[model samples]
Target: MSSAVDTLEQSEAYMENPKLQKYFKNVWLKEKERWVSMYRVGKMRVPVGTNNGVERQNRMLKECHIKFQVDKSLSGLVKVLHKDFLPAGYKKYIDENALASDSYRSYLNYIPPYLHNRPPKIVKHCMKRLNNASSIPTDDVTRVGCTVFKVRSSESLLEYEVYFGSESEFPKCSCPDFKKWFLPCKHMFAVFNKYDDVSWNSLPKWYSDSVYITLDNYVIKTSDYNSLKQSDIALSR
Candidate 1:
């Protein structure tokens, strides 16, 4: 068997055994199993290397509004989970499954046109005040699609939302500003613009705008990416 296949099988064997799977769940089995399962289960390997989509968002939820010492009200937590977590996950899912079936048109509709286009003038004006090269939210570096917030001056950095997918196709930005003003924020523009890897999930918060854009490759990365990309995702019994 090919090396990739062998590695994949080993992963399956380990996952099938509950005893073996726990090691992975606890972050024990480093690379061999971690990547094998990630690519196999997440089904995609966008720019970020694996489907860190869900994990990244969760981390943001805890770090931003949910501090460890302070406890939020039940209703507040619900708002955070619904308004924050659920939409983040669904956005990633919809972006991946778009164009797969006519039924997914509802999701596709959310992807805005001029998505790839640069931010509008008014948004651009707002962005001018906040153009720092190193201003990402959250020290936790594992997550992607974070919502960056401005501090007292929109400069020093305050908080960020874990944005996973863009509702737009082209100049994809996950920030609410993308919708409120139709301009790609620095983070979204920065990530999508630079990386030609087609896997946005892998790229860091920086280097997004520094890269040039091209038409040859522009596929968004999602959790189910690996399965969808592979022709052999499913087999007939």
Candidate 2:
């Protein structure tokens, strides 16, 4: 990433434009950490790299719900959204099985089929990466300790260390992807396939906490307002 930036800095087009160069150095360089995914951590690491979803939803609201009507008053718009749009969207969500009853199960009650306990989206990502894990040569994955393994990258031929920690700590990997995303990488999955003893306890609490809050909030909103307030308090702590 730095190399790419350096190359851009040296380009004739960039050098010729004084304002562009000033903007690049003063704004882009200074704020790179905010925009760059590699510098993000914790919840920011989730794969929300694009605003396409927001843009699409906005487009839907304008085109479908408002029907490009610009003359509606504030209350009129709210009435349309509350009475016509939101309910329709909610019904569609339920009809599509997006909000399943199983999703509302408490952490203690939820027993994931996979070794690691993750949100469905993350589980799907890991399932896709399993193919890459399978392709890894057994010789490439060297067990360093009971909780540590070194897996060589297929593309770069660089060895990255994968660390399996307790339930309180997130499993770590030396790979750039893991460092950037704070999520399990292919190397971690490789270790999981190799070792039978590693269980769901190896996963961090953050994912489970996030899942619990999201599911519980969704169910509690209409059923129990006090429970929602309690959930908020727990989250704040």
Candidate 3:
């Protein structure tokens, strides 16, 4: 099957080096899975075909490398990455359009967020969350102060004001799941996940940033449209 490496090799038509063929051919042949990965996503205009795109991507990654190295933690990097992907264009989500492409889901993930134009406020909170929790675990979270929470169900949303004194230890989330089954509830995590930093305008606009709204996953790619055949891509070998 034609793959990304094949595409890269194909693009060598405009190149001067014959040695590149011998070298990349060896690399491509050795890496069977990595080779065919690009067809799995419809995001990038190209994967390995041209030099300009790759060089630009590398330069962007280097900037991220600098930020993370200074912060000294991977979490800051991840949070920063999250904010970077916030809506401002420059992203291609995997919807029906992305799926219509032949091999768009098997091996591809989204681009690293560093390349996007991040706003100051969002990125400011991101850097702080990263800097403060740089030495801690992802699940190794901390909480302080009080915040309001709204719990939603099928019928209604319940509002609760959780209070923690200035010197008191932050309480675990009072959501039914955390209270009854000892799980990490969204509200409990939200109260302190956003860094209550010194700056006000720079503060993040989310308490639910740490919370995720996810549906159950299936072994196969689920689609709402039937224009394309529905094959079990989970086992597409």
Candidate 4:
């Protein structure tokens, strides 16, 4: 990545343009650590390498929700966001995903009778990756130690070292996806599938954070309330 950056910096267009040179030296170089995937990997939990999520949200707010509301006061804008846009968006998400069932919502307060011991969304993601691990042939998974393994990518064929740590430590994979997201990648799942007695306690504490669980509960309740309100409207009609 650094080599590519260096090559771009040495390009004729970059060398000729003083403003471009200034921006590259002053802003890009200084802020590279925050935006660069190579620098950010293993340092942050979010796997996103760009500000695309924030940019997309901002674009939605400006273009879709507030395009013709330039005369509105700050409080009125907040009202639109809190009372109209956000609720509608959340309801749409919940309805489309079908995530507001009573049984699923109950898992927020207690550990579900599951192996992963993570939030519903997280557990789903991990299980999806675990299923994908089956695509990687057994020949790709080479055991280096009792708790260590070298798993080769079925696509890239590149080898990654996976370490399933003890109860006190978290598991780790050398794969870029695991390093960037701080989540279990398919390579680690391959090792887990191979071993029957692998410890689930080795997962990071963030997976079990109360804050995320609470947020999930709040979303579920909001969805349930919206559904009930819609049903009431239909009954009245």
Candidate 5:
């Protein structure tokens, strides 16, 4: 299994295990006993790889519910959620994404330039996993292209697809964490740790930029930013 199609074929076989097939069929297969590819449904391209968004919404709702003094009818609850909860949540989400993007880029300006273009979280995770000398969680890596690999987990004995890209492309792992939460999994980071050439620059666009905010107007002048940064450092010293 070299291509993505081959990976799917392998996944089918893996899912065919009696116990595993039953669970996947009951939970994910849908319709008849036949399993359908989500891609074929045409809406699977959205960045949502997990239920974290729904989970977050549920948490927020529960918290808000606890603070309410009066009981609300179903319609009243819907009205409050629409008129209050969603707008505030939307604004907070936007501000945070923009702030995070600006801060990360600003951080890059002051930090050791050798770190390249990697996401801080991914770099931290990679170093942590490597320094701890965690057993290689994956084996049987088969490269399909310059940037794609199919690998198998030693624990679940399941296969996953991984893709690493150049500046124009973003890295992706077929694992649930990467797919659902849009975060790099240890498996993806392990690939980076194993290879010397793959660096932060190989990350997908979302890893470096705000997925929710545009950074075009937020570019900082290195000279001015660096001068202020150095002055701040001297003051701290």
Candidate 6:
């Protein structure tokens, strides 16, 4: 178990209830290699940690579409869901209404240079995380060194260490996002927020580069793909 996992497992007695123990043993424990660590999950760059986010969005869609007497045909519904429901709700609730909140409006304008080349989805994801980090009290962030800090979580009462390394090394966090995915997690952002000097320039190269390029390979060698094949050279035509 130790060899397969980077972190320690919860205590055996923590799941002592028979029902909880059975589920933990049969499901979570058995699948520990896949989901136990943030490192494992982060490498995949999965946009979701759980289906709840999707489910919640879907529920919102249903409420908005159904209550408003919108078109019901499958195609019409799909179009309205995107073109009407989601966008409208986002603009009305999150964006337009955001002007009322100083913090929200500030976050909207706060874009980093490295994020400029990223896809819109990735930008939004980072923004969401940044917003979350903002909610954490700045006083909770304790600097230990020029490049290291400890962030105390208000809700969980847990402390995560963040390291903003140099050119030879990327920034990292003791939290799972840094440990496994190599991406800066909210805790790292919280520490970064404390500094006026920090920007996406401090981010790992992998974060700003397109993830699709990382996932797939495309090679065109001058001697191979670019150069004519021997058979083509030999052909009379």
lDDT values, one for every candidate: 0.40, 0.63, 0.37, 0.64, 0.52, 0.58
Error of 6 at 178 (Å): 3.9
User: Compared with the true structure, what per-residue lDDT tens digits does model 2 show for residues 116-202?
Assistant: 333445654555666568888777888898788899999986899988765666568889777776656788878767777764445
Arranged by lDDT with the best first, the candidates are: 4, 2, 6, 5, 1, 3
Candidate 1 local lDDT, residue 206:
33
Question: How many backbone clashes can be found in candidate 3?
Answer: 4
Off by over 4 Å in 6: 2-113, 204-237
Clashing pairs in 3: 39-103, 40-103, 40-104, 76-130
Candidate 2's C-alpha runs over 4 A off are 1-30, 41-44, 52-54, 68-71, 86-112, 115-120, 137-139, 154-156, 166-169, 212-237
Q: Per-prediction TM-score, please?
A: 0.23, 0.63, 0.19, 0.64, 0.38, 0.43
Residue runs of model 1 more than 4 Å from their true location after superposition = 1-3, 7-46, 49-51, 68-73, 81-237
* Best of the two (3, 4) by TM-score: 4
Worst 10 residues of 1 by lDDT: 228-237
Residues 122-227, candidate 6: write the lDDT tens digits.
5555667777898988899988887778998767878998876665565677775556555557887787788777655565565445453121112111112222
Q: For candidate 2, give the lDDT.
A: 0.63
- For 2-102, candidate 1 gives per-residue lDDT tens digits of 57545754786875888766765466545555454433431222234347867876777788646752548888788877786678666544443333322
User: Model 1 compared with the native: what TM-score?
Assistant: 0.23
- Ten-residue stretch with the least lDDT total in model 3: 207-216
Compared with the true structure, model 2 gives a TM-score of 0.63
lDDT of 6 at 156: 85
Question: In order, what is each prediction's RMSD in angstroms?
Answer: 20.9, 8.4, 23.3, 6.8, 11.3, 16.8
Q: Which candidate model has the greater lDDT, 1 or 4?
A: 4
TM-score order of candidates, top first: 4, 2, 6, 5, 1, 3
| Tens digits of per-residue lDDT for model 4, 90-118 | 77666533343443333333222442223
Q: Write the per-residue lDDT of candidate 5 for residues 27-130, one digit (tens) a residue.
A: 65455223343433311233345669888877787687425836577887787688778876755544433333333345434333333233344344445544
Q: Is candidate 5 or candidate 6 better by lDDT?
A: 6
